[model samples]
Target chain A: MSEGLTFHFNVDGEDFTSAGQASVMMKKNLRQLGLPPEIIRRVSVAMYEGEINMVIHAGGGVADVNVTENYVEIILTDSGPGIKDIEQAMQEGFSTATDSIRSLGFGAGMGLPNMKRYSDYMHIDSEVGKGTTITMRVNIN
Target chain B: MTVKELAETDIFSPVTLPCGGREISGVYIGDLLSWVMGRASSGQAWITIMSNVNILAVASLADTSCIILAEGVTLEQEIIDTAREKEINILKSEKSIYDIAVFLSKII
Candidate 1:
């Protein structure tokens, strides 16, 4: 437990019903590691938002969580349509999700904002035609 | 108040009580899953009109006492099965979110 632990998950984009499965499993892993509840909640929320975004916008992706003594880092990589404007996407209510996605109780444009709010640090890398990757970290302290 | 007591009320009808016997400390009303995830606290009942399966994720993450599907929203079979498997309580209510919230405030 001194060095760090990394967990990887494949997010299924086809089934909207199973979108948050990765985040749920991540929460359980964090609990087993004896991380603080606050840290676990923050990481879980941030990762869950990213996972949902990947499903709704990016059509699924890969999630990697790195747990260390100081912080937990979540990396989401998707191969779907990438974001055109990172700044605008970071806004609380700006979204490009379809009407159907909104009907599912998501696509409120709060996903990225919530991720940033809960995490200690966040970074977004995207190419409009290529894909998007989001990295968020939460401090253990 | 315990979840059993709330379920007995006229407004709330328990669908599955995987973990409904626990005490409820408060109420949070919201439809947005991420918003509810960020705001709802542990031991609270979440009232929402959304009947998607993701609500179970939010409830489990937030550790809500039970989820009340307000406005007579019927949950899909997938959601009900998942809730049972996950051991989370799912309830149904014919009342609106506003009315459910009011009743919850008065009681719990």
Candidate 2:
């Protein structure tokens, strides 16, 4: 078996329904790589949340995943409106999503929190009107 | 109740899926992803109005057997395709999430 694997995807913001495609592929890849179910679940959940946030808030972005024997790393970068209040945005139930977004079944304000909760490490870099970059890692050990 | 019976219920009766008659028990209704993550049980049917791929991810984490997309909402073709590959059953109803949940409660 290969020692590691890397996967990349461009999240298209034009379609919210398509947001989790990359995460699904990553899960499939990790499963083929023979990773544990728990690890794959954690990575998939974390990346799925990031991918959704990218679409719902940032208008889409790029995702890079590095899968290794010990941990999985996911980096998501987007050029959408930067978060104004990172702290508040991180809080569960706090959301700035439009009613339209909410009606589509997202913008519940759980994206960031779920990402943080499922990953072992998470970092957010953003500026208002600029862009946001999130890095999350899940340990397999 | 099994997924088939849930599918047979008036609210969900119209929608048809390719899920091979998997049995489903209980139901979890919520749009709040985090709350559902913490509260939803594995193997239960998740009814939501959300039409995003993250719904599949959340269901996977909670170990849900299938998801019923309420409100006559349509999921993207890609999402449906991936769910099939993931072995996750997905059903869509013409009813709203609320109405579907109510129906699910009475039956299950």
Q: Quick one: best TM-score, which candidate?
A: 1
Residue A8 error for model 2, in Å? 0.4
Model 2, B28-60: lDDT tens digits are 887666567646666778887777676776776
lDDT of each: 0.89, 0.78
The residue ranges of model 1 lying beyond 4 angstroms of the native Cα positions read none
Best by DockQ: 1
Clashing pairs in 2: B3-B24
Local accuracy of candidate 2 as per-residue lDDT tens digits, A1-141 = 246678899999998766678887787788788888777777877888788888888889999998876789999999999999899999988988899777766677787888898899999999989899999999888
TM-scores of the candidates are 0.95, 0.77
**Ten residues in sequence with the least summed lDDT for candidate 1 chain A:** A100-109
Work out the iRMS of candidate 1.
1.0
Residue A137 of model 1 has an lDDT of 94
Docking quality tier of model 2: acceptable
User: Per-residue lDDT for A27 in model 2?
Assistant: 79
